[model samples]
Target: MADTEEMFLRAKHRTFSGLTEGSCPSTRSCGATAERLAERLAERLTEWLTEWLAEQQAERLTERLGERQAEQLTEWLAERLAEWLAERLAEWLTERLAERLAEWLTERLAEPLRDPEEAERQWTGPFCFIQAADPQLGLMKAWRIGDAVGGGDEWEEEVALTKQAVAGVNQLRPRPRFMVLCGDLVHAMPGTEFREAQERDLKEALSGTDPSIPLVFVSGNHDLDQVPTPSTVEQYCRAWGDDYFSFWVGGVLCLVLNSQLYFNGSACPQQKEAQEAWLEAQLSRASSAEPKPKHILVFQHIPLYVKSPDEQDEYFNLPQEARQSLMERFKRAGVTAVFSGHYHRNAGGCQDGLDMVVTSAIGCQLGDDTHGVRLVAVTADAVVHRYFSLEQLGQRGVNEELRKMLQAC
Candidate 1:
């Protein structure tokens, strides 16, 4: 019985030891050395944890980086688009406005006041016109002070005279067709003091004239600057109509010249050349026109000659070379008369079928002639003219002889 019990106990011991050896425990009671077993378990746990953490963190980091990049790119594009739109809009508006203004100014200068296609060139009948000059507004005061170049501050005396002249023109029996003031509209030079005021007062005085009579303005030395540039000439045109223009009344072709151009063209040679070309065309065309003018006349502020065609050059007359050339041109063109008034007195003569009429001033005179205007009669036969003082013309009218001549047409 002892030997059988010993065999069973040995069997039980072997079975139990096999079970403990095969089992793995996480505690220090394991069969292997405790330190080595613990080290191997810790190494396996650390490897698993590191691999799991890497998967989760890498996914989140990729998602966050992608979202931030998209947001920043969207913001950058939006800001660039807004800046470009603002810059383009301003450039477009400024360019369009400048083009429109230039077109308007060009149209206004070409047409001026008259319409030739509307038959203003047609002949109605024989008529008479009044020619006058130098209603120089501030001249009286300037002459009194012995300094006409400086101009005067006051113009009351000349203003009164201009009003009287207008009143006299209104009192005529058969009213004059038009009144031409041959130049020196004011004593003040351009850019001088009292220029605007003098022009204003003179215009106010002449406004009293009858509306039937149009006023023809001629530019004088005072109206043009002493040495005229392109800028000065443009300024003069703006103030007193065109510096030079032509018109017709009762089949008479009247050519008004800017004599200042011929006098001094050093500053504006182009302007001088243009006027010469225009005058040449005008004279050549009028000489052989289809309808034909009753008589061709020339009006200007400065005379080709003050007294005689062959006279020498002076302040009051055109240069001798210009005078001869113009006289030859006028004779060729059948121009019957040339009227002017910078001499401040009546001093001109007729030579070789051309009548040079230099009418006196209506303002301060530099000579012995009284302040007056000229009455010009146009007929199928001949052109006739007579100078009369303001008092004589206003009170007496044209005498019966002159009245008969005007009605003869």
Candidate 2:
């Protein structure tokens, strides 16, 4: 009979070696390894228990046990062995499966960047791009805001404003190389009719843009539900390829993030873990490239910090722990700036030699600011940006009263 230590070593060896093959065998048979292991374990446990029982009986009872007593002992030992084997096998399988899963995830997460050359080509020359956020196409409709003073549909006003923003991008002297809607392209709870309608309206508005200009969408909390989940993210991804990803424009690397993953009280642990892993890999690759990108700019829905990096937690910003850790990572990777939208107002500040620019919304007037989009021009040495109001883009439906009320807030 094998000793306990030897049996354990054999089990460990079989478990480790069989992991890659997706099967384990007990003894010389090729049938279901798990079942075989269970059977073998039960047999071994019964043998061990019988031997121990016999030794105890020899010491306590000088006379040999009767046939009935021996039969009862065998039955009890078999029952105990079955229960013990069942629990042990279950625990072993769970541990092994979890280990394999973790290993596979690590390998996948470490995969090299896809199409590095393509990313380089997209950003090979100095160019400009447009960033528009929080169009919230059905926001007014959801809020029950009435039609405009000019008697237009409440929802159409949002769609028209987005169209105006797109027109603004097309009119740029050298049309922007691309346009990115940072987040909140539509405003409605997920899995709703209004959400679908808002999305269609947004697509129509974007269709008016020059075909040559590329469009990218970032997922915002509003676009997903208030708290993003796998299903909500899938809905966003059906419209946009990925909620978070990186692209290049000349020497600049633009990273768009799903900030909802880091939003306080938003329980998206799997996404948060995966994004963190993917982001680390991307940053590491960029940092080690033969000729690193000259600048790294990030876009997302929520600001990492509002007034300062050390600012206390707020609904409008990322929680403090995540904020500080992300800032450190960005600083280490030499990120030049981060552009975000959620506060619905323009704000700018610099910390740790990095700039944080939060743009105003394109759908509604939240603060004293007008509804607008920011145009960013990337040069060899500097990045220049300016805000353009919808009115500046030939949309004369500016809501002066809303602006006044916002300012009084």
Best by TM-score: 1
> How high a TM-score does candidate 2 get?
0.64
Give candidate 1's TM-score.
0.70
- List where candidate 1 sits over 4 angstroms from the true fold: 1-118, 399-401, 407-409
| lDDT (CA) per prediction | 0.73, 0.68
Per-residue lDDT of 38 in model 2? 46
TM-score (all chains, Cα) for each model: 0.70, 0.64
Sum up the clashes in candidate 2: 2
Runs of candidate 2 exceeding 4 Å displacement: 1-116, 119-125, 141-154, 264-266, 394-409
Error of 2 at 142 (Å): 4.2
Lowest summed lDDT over 10 consecutive residues: which window, candidate 2? Answer: 13-22
Query: Which candidate leads the pack in lDDT?
Result: 1
- Clash totals for all candidate models: 0, 2
| Residue-by-residue lDDT tens digits, candidate 2, 343-395 | 88888689877888888989876689998988776766666666778777444
